[model samples]
Target: MAGLTKDTPYPTEIKLHQKSRILDITFSDGKTFQFPCEFLRVYSPSAEVSGHGPGQEVLQTGKKMVSIVKIEPVGNYAIQLNFTDGHNTGLYSWDLLYNFGLNQDKMWQRYLQRMDEAGASREPASRASTAQHSCK
Candidate 1:
């Protein structure tokens, strides 16, 4: 993991803005990131989202309006984000969070591009289909 370095810093402040549907995170190194709920939801590190192996990433669709209902601290290394959509598997560690923050723009662009190519919308997925479905 290139994101992990000798001076890897943990989160100093984590704030969720309900009105804006954003999660703000500040690291001990003075770096800060503002992540949209949808971004976090779709980019979840869980197997449900990331899949069990490479080239098997389940492209997350329809999560624009998702919101974080709760934030559970996972020991002292990571935080478990509980989404209003009932997704709480992703454990966002300090290094992972920092990496996501650093690559936010590129990652989001890639996500949007992939969505467009697959004709996926940002709207929340319907209840009829919530299981493992891949677009790539």
Candidate 2:
């Protein structure tokens, strides 16, 4: 697979819009993307977020209040996201972010379907009983 290069930096700028719940990412090459907070939340690369396998995927709800706490670089390939809700384990690679940028529509549609099936909304975790099985 082809990896990203300095000449192809993933994004030149990333802005977190608190009120809009959207992350605005501008690629160095002039590509721009706007990802919703819920979208970024559900598609988080953490195993705590993505689960282990296809069928084991988890639906993240109640993230309307969530915010990006930090963005830590991971070498030349990826970055780790620290969310305000204290759930930070995802390492979003350049390729993954790029793909997510490209496939936002389809992935979000699927996420919505899963949320509907689970009768879940992107709300904050309130009850301990709401805890589901881990992907491990």
Candidate 3:
């Protein structure tokens, strides 16, 4: 949403590949991108993830298996992605999503580097496994 105007390219079709954990999006400019759910969740544009100021970003961890549960349109500019983890605050604008898709490889590598720097693991929380064990 930052510095983006109505001229920004919007998605023509958005498809979810549940098995592959990919979101396939095609823009008005004929560019298509496949974004992994993990990538999208970790790079969420919400304040909780991106923060309001520089150096304030909260590093997202244990989100390797996160998924998109739902997508709700936001007016005429963006969509609110409801993640399986219940985080739905981010409004992913058209331009932002496109940029993310375009630079995903580099961004993903940067994310990996940052995670390693912080000793963070991409493995989904072990708490879910523990809870399942307790229920059995």
Candidate 4:
């Protein structure tokens, strides 16, 4: 991942509200965004979710209740979010986070549309489904 650029908006404050499952972040540009945990998980920058190239993106399901358990800074440019669902690969950079904040509504709508088309549910899968997907 690339480091901060001269034009990147640096985050001034980052707070995770566990009860609300929201990540509240403020940038040096004086803009603040409150991101729901589910949104971040579904739109993760990790290759596992985003894939190595276009058209290979994996649709993340059963993450409606996922929350950030920990936020670890990766140098000065990004932060690694350790989620309750055991996802910790994505390195959320300042620019990416800012973009997510800016386009949250549109992105969320797209996600919902995709889910609807796939006949998927945001709710976590049941034990039977989990067992079906487990390794042999």
Q: What do the candidate models score in CA lDDT, each in turn?
A: 0.87, 0.74, 0.86, 0.88
Stretches > 4 Å off in candidate 2: 1-9, 125-136
- List runs of model 1 lying over 4 Å from the truth: 2-6, 125-136
lDDT tens per residue, model 1, 13-116: 99999989999999999999999998999999999999998878888877877899999998878999999889999999889999999999999999989888
TM-scores, in order shown?
0.88, 0.78, 0.88, 0.89
lDDT of 2: 0.74
Worst 10 residues of 4 by lDDT: 127-136
lDDT of 4 at 8: 83
Best by TM-score: 4
Off by over 4 Å in 4: 1-3, 127-136
Tens-digit lDDT track for model 3 on 70-113? Answer: 98999877899998899989999898998998899999998888
Poorest stretch of ten by lDDT in candidate 3 = 127-136
Q: Candidate 4's error at 121, in angstroms?
A: 0.5
Per residue, candidate 2 scores C-alpha lDDT tens digits across 25-103 of 8776677889876677778988877788777766687765678877788886777877887877888777677778878
Residue range 51-75, candidate 4, lDDT tens digits: 9998888999878778999999999
